[model samples]
Structures are given as structure tokens and as C-alpha cells.
Target: MEWGRCSEKELKDLEAIVGAENLSTGESALGLVSRDESYYTPKIPPQVVVMPASAEEISAILKIANPRRIPVTARGAGTSIEGNPVPLFGGIVVDMQRFDSIIEIRPEDFITVVEAGVGYKDLNKALGRHGLFFPPDPGAAATIGGMIGNNASGVRTIKYGATKDYVLRMTVVLANGKIMEIGSLATKSSSGYDLARLFVGSEGTLGIVTQATLRLAGIPAHHSAAVATFPTLQAAAQAVFDIMRWGFSPTALEVLTADLVQMLNRDRGLGLREEHTLFLEFQGASEIALEEELGAVQDLCQEAGALSFQPGLGIDERNKLWEARYETYESIKHTHPGADPFVADVAVPISRYPEILEYTAEIIRDHGVTGYPFGHAGDGNLHVVFMGDASDEEEWGRIVRANEAIVSRALELGGTCTGEHGVGIGKQPFMEREHGASLGLMREIKSLLDPQGILNPGKVFP
Candidate 1:
């Protein structure tokens, strides 16, 4: 859809609503919020940036922009790996950082009311005082609002579940500037329409979330971590299944290939084994029980033909070992500066996890494409970074083909096109292939909520 340009009258009116101090039409601000942390191309700058301080202001802005058919893409921290908050139509980018506030913490109720701009780290820091934590740490400085947008799940997702699971309520401003306070605090509600779930992963296409009430989990008293290296990637993936089937609930179960390990070692020189490894951690209240849990997981790793397994005896040691898992993305980029990184992620059934990884490896090897493979094996979410030759068109084509083949195979294995990263512009082509005719239903819902098609245009569907 061709979008209407922001006229002088419209810009002046927006400035009046948000005040001149909170809005900008400058090129620098437009470019900064143009794209997220993804390789999705052609950064389209918005006409204006609005920094609304409250939900009321957001409602008013939406009320004006929606009628004017101005695209308003809600942005939070700009940490998305999928161009989720990128403005595709060059409309208005609503900067949500000013709304940062941990409004209230109901410790006794195990729920916290926070503005959409509040960071998960700060919320957890405040919750730590009450011995509680917000689960679904997406391992980035992603705001609670963005996490809700993608329904983000991180390493701990093996145990804690995703963002949609923790969201109890939300104050969402629809496209027409109507504020709908959806969801309830009650643990179980057989109420009409689970509206909160609809918006949780809507990617701000349905409505703009201004505030959220998140469920909190208590901080476990005792926790232990272990790192084990396997001879092959399949062995590491299978170990996750074996450990899980043994009735063990590990907090985080990650799988990293030898290439990633080598990159991590060369970049950080931590002396880690350059082999396919599984970074596993267990959490509980009892120190002895946690130790036993780690030992049990280690035993399973040994049974899965692990070369060596090391269970950290202290917290610092465990964290140091686990650091390898977090640094793989940066390590790949730093190690291969000229290679354009294409980090594609997909999730399949647990039993099919190893099958897909092996399949992906075969495709990569056949195409002669270099990439780093890693994932949260505990939940069958595999993330691979294809470092395509930056200036080589032929090699870039191979990388693109490999990505397509990988997503296709994941869908064939009863998985999704995206495991955590939402269907931003990069993943649009695969929506119809993944969702089939249901893609029409999604469009219908999009049209119903945003009849003018102004909210996050040219996303989720082709």
C-alpha cells in the first residue's frame, strides 16, 4: 500500500500534541530508529519521531495519526533481530523510552505493574529486593514492551516459558485511539476473549501497548551450572533430550557447535574445548539437591558420549563458563568483519531437533557456506549465523538458499519459521509458506483492528 506523506499541517499538529520538545523530524533521529539490529535492508526513515510521556498522550497521538493514515511503529530499546520495530512506510516512530517507570510492585500478589518502556533488568533488580524475578529473559536490553511484542523466550525458556505466559494484563491503545485495558490478574479466568494473548505477540500491529502487569517468579535459593563437550553436534542435541527424559528440569540447556566454540576461544581465549558443547544449568532451593541435579545431568552427558563434562563448584565459575554462550553472536561478527551475518533461528520438535541440525549442516556443507550454529536445545530452538562473503553476490545467494532450505525443513518437521524472532520484514516471504491459508485470517484480523492498515504496515505477511 502506498502511504500518504506527512503534510506540514499534520507535522505541526503532532508537534502541538507532543510539544516541540518531544517530537523530531530531523534526519539523524529518523535514521537512528530506521532499522533494528537485523540485516533487513533499506532503512526507511520516519517523517517524525514522537516521544509520548504517558498512555493518554499515546492515545491522543494514535487518535490523530490513525485517522490521518500515518504509520506509527512503536519502538522499544531497538534490540530486535527481525526489524520488528522498523518503520517500513516512513510514517511516525513512537519512541517509548520516556515511558520507563516501574509503576507498582505487588509482592504479595506476585505481580508487578510497569510501563511498556521499563527494561527487564531494572524490573528484575527491583523485584530482587522482594526475592522475585520476571521470567523470560531475552538476553538483550529488550524492554518489557518489545518482549511482549515478540512473545520473546530466552535460554531459561526451557524452564520458565515465554513472555506471553507471564503477562496478566495490559493497557493497550488501539489504532483508533481507544484504550482497552485487557486481561486480568486472576490466575484462571474463563472470561470472554483472551484479548491479552492476542496483543502479547501482535508485534504492535494490533494495538500499541503502553503499560503491562507482569507475573513474577521467586528467585531460586540454589543454582548450579555445568558445561559438557560432545564429539558431534547431534550428540550435544541428543544429550538435551536424554537429560530431559530422565525427569530433570534444567533452567537452561544450550548447544553450541565447534565453529562457535573456536570463534569464542579465539576471540576471548577462555581455553574452552573447540568441540560441540552443551551449556547446562539447574536451579532449585536446596544446595545439595542442585548439586545432585547437576551430577545427574552430567551423567546423562557422559552417557551421550560427551568428551568431558565440568560442573562448576561456584557461582562465579559457572557464570564464567556460561559467558561463552552469550558471546557467540558478537564473536562471529568480530572474527569475520567482511562477512554479512545472517542469523536465522527456527524450532522443531525435540526428537526432530538433531535431525534438523544435521540436515542444516549437510546443506551448509554442500553449498560451502560458513556459519556458526547454536541453540536452546532444551526447547529445540536452533539459531544459526550464516557469515556470507560480504562482497560476493554468488556466495550471498548460497547463504539465502541455505536459509530458505533450513526454514522449509523446520516447517516440514512441524516447527515454525521463527522460534523467538517475530515475522518482521526479513521473514515475511515465509509467512504464507509457514502459515498457509491462515495468513488470510491474520490479514483479516489486521484489517479489523487497523482498518486503515496504518499500524506497522508491510509486516507479518507479504
Candidate 2:
């Protein structure tokens, strides 16, 4: 389907709805919203960038765009690495930054009402006051809306969950200027179709979320962190699988490769052992309970052939370690000055975690490319960042082939093309192979919700 262009009259209509100051067609403004943190580039630049402060304003803008068939791409903090928010068709890019507002925090109910543009760290800071937090740590300065768009989850997901688990309700603006609320404020519901969940990871192809009510988790009274080194990546992965299989509940379980550990040591002055390592964090209600659990974990790691197991890190040391872990992507990028990273995010069953890691290492070695493998190992998620020069088609081709091989292996192991990152341009090709016949139903749902297909035109579908 051909998308309508943003004409001068349509631009005037948008400015009238959002005011001239809230709208911009400037070169810098268009450039800013044209792409996200992904390696993909936009096919064309957006004609205008509009920052709407309310659902009503967004409704008005969508009203004008829907009839005209102008593509509307909703953007949050622009932190997604999958090109989830790129304005590929280039019509009106709706910037949601101005909608930042923490409306309400009901500590008793373990719920919080917030506007879509609020940052993840900002909300956590406020929630910390009440001994509660929204526990889908995506490790980026991402907006709540963007997190919901991708259904993001990080290391903590092994114990807590992803953004989709915490989202109770959302106020969304559908195509053609319809403002509707989805989901329930109650804890559980056997209600109709789960429209709230449908919109959570839709990547704004179905609707634009304006506000949300999220479920929160309480802060644990006691927490402990440890690092376990292994002789090989497979050994570390086996330990992770065994720990989870034996009913060990860790708050965060991350695995870093030897090369990645070396990079972290050089970049962050960590001075860590440059070997395959596992960073583990456990939280509980009492110190004694945590200590007991750590002791068991150490025994399990040793049984799995751990080279060394160091447990019981202090608060400051744990914080510094996590800070460096969160900066893994940046550290890799910094190490390779002018190279672009092609990240492959995949997940499989816990039993197959070790096999996938070994397969990934082999694929990287066979392709003759620099790859960093790491991720939330407890949940069987693996992220391999392949660094290369984008302009060098030959070298980048090898990286692409290696990524495809890894994803194919994950799918064969009963996994998914993307564990947390959404199906933006990067993983579109694997949608059919991953979903099979169900992909057609998804496209039908997309068409049903957006007949004109003006919302995030080139996304989700292949």
C-alpha cells in the first residue's frame, strides 16, 4: 500500500492542533527522529516532528493523518537498537518526550500510574521511596512507552519479568483519532481478548500508548552478589542451566565471554579475570536465607567445573560491577573505534542453553568475525554483538550470515528470533520461519486494527 505524503496543508493542520512551537520541519529535527540506535537507516526522512503533550493532541494529529494515509511513527527516548521507532515511511513522527508525568503512585496497591514518556530510571527513583520498583530493567535510559513497545526485559527478568508482565492498563490512541483505554486495574481478570497485551509489544503499529498503570515489585530486604569463573563458555552456561533447573532463584544471572571480560577490564578498570564468567545476584527477605542460597549456588558451580567461585560482594562492589555490566555494549563499541555492531538476540530452553552457546562460538569462529556473546543466562537468552564496518559489504555479509545461523539454531531449539528486542527491521526476515502459520493471523490483526496502515508503516511484518 502506498502511503500519503505530508503536504503543506497537512503540516498546517498538525501545527494548528499542537501549536507551531510543538511542531518542527527543521532539518535537525527531522534528522533526530529519522533513525534510532539501530544499524538500519530510514528509507526517507519524516516530513515533520510533532511533540504532543496529551492524548487529545495525539488524537487530533492522528485524525488528520489517518484519512490522508500519512504514516505515523510513535517515538519515545530513541534508545531501541532494533529500529523499533524509526520513521521508515516518513510522514509525521510523534515525539512523546513532552508527555512525561508521574500521575499517581499507590504503594498499597503496588501500582503506579504514569504518562508514557517517563524514563525508566526516573520512575525507579520515585518507586524506591516506597520500597517498590517496576522490575523490567532494559539497561538503557528508555522511556516507559518504548519499553512497552518492545516488551523489554533485562538480567532481572530471570526472577521478576518483562514490561508486559507489569503493564496493568494503558490509555491508547488508535488510528482515526479514537482514544480508548484497555486492560484492568484489578490484579487478575478473565476478561475478553487481552487487548492491553496486544498493544504492549505491537511496536506502535496498532496504536500509540499515552499513559499506563503498571504493577510494581517490592524491594528485597537482603541481597547478595557473586561472580563465578569457568574454564569455557559452555561450562558457565551449563552452570546457569543447572542452577535454574535445580530451583535456584537468582534476581539477576548474567554471563560474559572471555573477550567481553577483557574489554570490560580495559574500559572500566575492573581488573576482572579475563575468562568466561557468571555474575549472579540473589535477593531474599533475610541475610541467612541469602547466604544459604549462595552456598548452594557455589557448590553447584563447583560441580559444573567452575574454576573459581567468589561470593558475598558488598553493596558498593556489587553496584560498580553492575554499572560496568550495563555498559557492555558501549564498551564493545568503544573498543572498536569505527565499527558498527549487529546484535543477535535469541533465547531457548534452559536445557539447550549450553548447546546454543557452543554453537554460537563455533559460528563466530567459522565466519572469521569479532563477536561478543553474553546475556541473561538464567532465562536462556543470548546476545552476540558482531562488530564490523558497515560500508564493507563483504565483511558485513559474513556477520549477517553468522547472525542468521545463530537465530536459525535458536529457532530449531524451540526459541524465538528476539528475546526482548522487538521485530523491527533487523529480525523481520525470520518472522515467517519463527511464527509459521500464526504469522498470517498476526497480519490480519494488524490490518483489523489499522486498515489504512498509517501507524508505523514499515515494521513487524516482513
Each candidate's lDDT (Cα)? 0.87, 0.93
Error of 2 at 337 (Å): 1.0
Q: Please list the residue runs of candidate 1 whose C-alpha ends up more than 4 Å from where it truly belongs after superposition.
A: 42-44, 389-391
The candidate 2 region of ten consecutive residues with least summed lDDT is: 35-44
lDDT per residue, candidate 2, 22-124, as tens digits? 9999999999998788877678778899999999999999998998899999999998888999999889999999989999999999999999999989999
lDDT of 2 at 161: 86
| Candidate 1 lDDT | 0.87
Q: Clash totals for all models, in order?
A: 0, 0
Q: For every model shown, what is its TM-score relative to the native structure? A: 0.97, 0.99
What lDDT tens digits, residue by residue, belong to model 1 across residues 1-462?
Answer: 567667898888888888999999888888888878876543455889999888788888887787778888999998888788889888898999997999999999999999999999999999999999999978878999999999999899999999999999999999999988999998679899898998988888999999999999999998888889999878888898898888899999998888788888889876888898888888899989988888778888998999999886488777766765676787788888877788888999899998988998898898799877789899999888998775688988899889889999999999998999898887887888888888899899899999998888877878
Residue 352, candidate 1: Cα error in Å is: 0.5
Worst 10 residues of 1 by lDDT: 37-46
**Model 2 misplacement above 4 A:** none
